[model samples]
Target: MLTYEEIMLLITALASVFSVIAVYYAIIEKNLVRAVVFSAIQSTIYAFIYYMFMAPDIVLVYIPVAVGLYPAVILILISKTEKVEKQ
Candidate 1:
């Protein structure tokens, strides 16, 4: 059985891996808003990793900026430059 610290490390590693995948999806997605939302999901996972490391301050800031404000701004910008995708 792994120790508590080892398990936490594993979880952090997995979070980073998933974050990378989210970033890849964000880059390839045709929809700008969907890509921004995927990036938010990635940031949320990173916030969870920070929380696991006992860093509440980072979690608070990251959650608001990365998961909340950043996406909101991007969504607003997308709305302003709205273009219909051929599907």
Candidate 2:
């Protein structure tokens, strides 16, 4: 069985990798709404990684701004514009 530290490390690694994939998808997505969702997923993964690292303060602030507020604002802005990229 893996030890506690080993498990935590593995989780962090997996989260980090997934976050990278999320970021890539967010950038390449032509649909604005889908891009926003991917961006939110990346932010949520980051928040979880922060929590795993035991940084409560950073996680608290990041969760509100990155995962919540930023995505909501972007989605609202997307609603005001074209849903898909022209190119």
Which candidate has the top score in lDDT?
Answer: 2
Let me know the TM-score candidate 2 reaches against the reference structure: 0.93
After superposition, the stretches of candidate 1 with alpha carbons farther than 4 Å from their true spots are 83-87
Score each candidate by Cα lDDT: 0.88, 0.95
Clashing pairs in 2: none
Task: Give per-residue CA lDDT, model 1, range 1-87, as digits (tens).
Answer: 999999989999999999999999988888787888899989899899899999999988899899889999888888898733446
lDDT of 2 by residue, 1-87 (tens): 999999999999999999999999999999999999999999999999999999999998999999889989998898998899998
**Backbone clashes in each candidate structure, one number apiece?**
0, 0
Best by the TM-score measure: 2
RMSD of each: 2.1, 1.0
